[model samples]
Target: MEDNIRNSDRAPLPVGLYPHARKVGGLLFLSGVGPRKKDSKNIPGVELNDKGEIVSYDIETQCKSVFENVRMILEDCGSSWDKLVDVQVFLTNMKDDFSTFNKVYADYFKDIQPCRTTVEINALPTPIAIELKCVAEVSS
Candidate 1:
C-alpha cells in the first residue's frame, strides 16, 4: 500500500486511539510505545504504591520492553530493527534513569546506531517510566 496504518498483534496495544505505526512512501512512523503489554494495565518493572503512585521502576526493563514493542511494529509494517532511522525517548526521570536506559539501549542498538534523543518528562499517559517514538525505512 502506498499509504497504510499498521498495528501489530505481537506488540502492546497503544494507549490512545492511534495506530501502532503508519507508512507513507518507504518510511514507517511508529507511535510512541510504552512498557505496558496488550490487555494489561500493569506496566512492566513498575511498582505502584497503595495510593496508586509510582514507588519504583526498573529503567532497564522498561527500555527493553519498549524496544521489543517498536521492533514488533516495524516488522508488522514490513520493516526491521536495522531499518530504524530515528528514535525519540521520553523518561519520567531522566537524571535517575538515563544511565541505565543508555546501557540497555546499547545492548540493542550498538550496531544499528539510529539517531536518538532522550528527554525528561513529568509523566506519561500511563504509569510507565519510558516511552519511545521511532521511524524506520520500510523494505520493499
Candidate 2:
C-alpha cells in the first residue's frame, strides 16, 4: 500500500511567489529575503547618510534590518532562526563593513551556527547595505 499524506493547511505568503511551503521529504527550501514590507517599494528603516554637502552611507543599520528581514521570512515558512542551515550574505562594501556586519550577525545567530558565506558586490538597489539569503529545516 502506498502512503498518503496531505498538507493543505499551511498559510500562503502574499508575494507573487510560491505559496504553502514546499517540502521535499523532510527538507524545506525558502527564497531570498530583503527588507521590503508587504506594500512598500523601498525598504523601511534605510536612511541615506548625508555629509556636510553630500550624502554618504550607513552600513550598521542596514545590516541589522537585513537580519530582521531574514528572521521574518523564516517565521513565515514555519521555521525559526535556530533551524537555519545555511546563509548567504551580499554586500556592496565588504572590506569596509565586514567587521561591523559580523558584529550584528553574532547577535542573531549566537547559539545556532549555520554555514554562511559573504560576498562583495558593486551595488544594491538603492543604498541598501546588505541582502541575505538563507536555507532552513523544519522539524518533522
Candidate 3:
C-alpha cells in the first residue's frame, strides 16, 4: 500500500514532479530534498550565476538546512529521527565539502545514527551544494 503526504507544511514542497514523501510497505520514502525554503527559490548556502551554476557555497550551512528539512518531514509524517534507517547524500563537490558535510551530519545523526551513503555528483536540480533523501519506518 502507498500513501502520499503532499500537503505537508513541515517540510518544503517538492521542487519538481513528485510528492514530499510517500509511505509504501510500512516505510516512508522521501524525495531528494534540497536546502531551499518553502515557497521560495533561494538556497541557503548557494551562490549561483545567472546561468544557475555555483559561484560559491557553504556546505556546513547547506547540510544543516537539509537535515532540518528531513527532520521536519519525519515529524510531520509521524516519525522521528530514530525511525530513519537510511540516508543518501548527494554532494556537488565531495572533495571540498565532504569533511564539512560529514561534521554537520554527525551533529544530527550521531545519536539516531541511520545508515548513510554519500556520493559525489556533478549537480542537483537546484543550485544547492547538497541534497538529502532518506527512508524511515512509518509510525502508527
TM-score per candidate:
0.94, 0.71, 0.91
Give lDDT for model 2.
Answer: 0.63
Tell me the tens digit of each residue's lDDT in model 3 across 15-107: 667777887767888889888887777888879898978888888888888988888888887677789999999998999889888888888
Off by over 4 Å in 3: 1-7
Worst 10 residues of 3 by lDDT: 1-10
The TM-score obtained by model 3 is 0.91
Error of 3 at 39 (Å): 1.5
Query: Between prediction 1 and prediction 3, which has the larger lDDT?
Result: 1
The regions of model 1 sitting more than 4 angstroms off are 1-3
Error of 2 at 18 (Å): 6.7
Which residue pairs in candidate 2 collide? none
lDDT of 1 at 4: 87
Better model by TM-score, 1 or 3?
Answer: 1
Cα lDDT listed for each candidate:
0.89, 0.63, 0.83
Report the alpha-carbon TM-score of model 2 versus the true structure: 0.71
